[model samples]
Target: MAATIRFLTARGVPVMAHVGLTPQAVNTFGGYRVQGLGDDAERIRRDAGAVTEAGAFSVVLEKVPEPLARAITAEIAIPTIGIGASPACDGQILVVDDVLGMFTEFRPKFVKRYAELGSEAEAAIGAYADDVRERRFPAAEHVYATASKAGDVA
Candidate 1:
């Protein structure tokens, strides 16, 4: 993360670090629960400090204890985007696919579904299959004879 930040900043790009309840740490967190994030808050504090020190322009806190998230955000010089962290944070982000309901089987607690893309796509595919089975497809322009009067080539 430090190396990536340095590389990006060198080229004038701003990088953001992610801390707390990181989905990559899902197994470690014992599955998508808000991190209690301890009273000492040392780990979160250190995380914020390191990201800022490493020259990241911002950091994100996801599903962390609200107080800890606020404290880290307050102490850190850069912005702290939050997801299920709290409104006190500088910004928020949501996964596009999740919000669009691409995966109806799973929905994160923080996301507000805007549409059922999964059902729509499934219905569309089902319709296409029905059309194919009913010989409703290949209307004129959709198919052509491979055979020619001169010869049938393989």
Candidate 2:
């Protein structure tokens, strides 16, 4: 991972490392649960340190204890972006779907939905389906005249 980070940074490509509750490792972690608790905190700390040392411009600390996140943020030279972590982080981020309430499968504890776009989208789709079933769609304005009907054929 450090090699990859170094390679990217060496080429002037900015790298942001994600640690603690990495979504890609969800299955290995047994689910989307908070990481870096108790002894595990040390591992997260080391991961952040390694990434920073390897030239990461920033790191995301996700779903870890507040104190741990804060500690890592202070310890690291690069900025710390928090997701379900401490407010003390240099910046914060949340999944766009979660913010818009478009994803209903699972809601994480840290997600605070600002809008229920999923429900609105469902209602819209239902309305469109009803229109189609009732033959209300494909009204006169919806169809285009063929060349013969438009008297364009020689």
Candidate 3:
């Protein structure tokens, strides 16, 4: 916490430390499942306390028990950004692709699909290719000549 805060404060970037179901710990955490359930809640509380005490500007509690997350948020002076945690957080962030329906194989309930940029981009490229084949692009003055134009050599 202190180290995170110190670094962020010095660099002028907001701090967001992750705990509970951090992807880096996915194997130990048993996949991307929620954490802080059952007996683990207390441990989470302690961890959150330690983080807050250390002076972290903010924390990201991913895939944690909602109740425990809420409690941690209430206890901490700094903000908590819940990726898969709770609604009680100060703010939330989502990957544009996932929320926009780009990743259809996996989806979290909390994520709200914003757009379908994947499909949009694909269609745009297809249209551009078609235009190129039909000589729709590089019209007249759009391209340069190998040699100077009729009046250029003068």
Residue pairs with backbone overlap in model 3:
2-54
The superposed Cα distance between candidate 1 and the true structure at residue 67, in angstroms, equals: 1.5
**Candidate 1 residue 139 C-alpha distance from true site, Å:** 5.4
Residue 25, model 1: lDDT of: 76
RMSD of each: 5.9, 5.0, 5.9
Model 1: pairs clashing at backbone N, Cα or C within 3 Å: none
Candidate 2 global lDDT: 0.93
Candidate 3 lDDT tens digits, 1-154: 4566666667776656777777777889877777888999888888777777665678888878778888988998888888877687777767677777775668776667877666787788899999899989868776665776788743
107-151 per-residue lDDT for model 1 (tens digits): 767788888899898899999999899999867666555545666
Task: Return the number of clashes found in candidate 1.
Answer: 0
- Candidate 3 displacement at residue 76 in angstroms: 1.0
Selected candidate, larger lDDT, 1 vs 2: 2
Best by lDDT: 2
C-alpha lDDT score of every prediction, in listed order:
0.81, 0.93, 0.77
Task: Give lDDT: candidate 2, residue 16.
Answer: 94
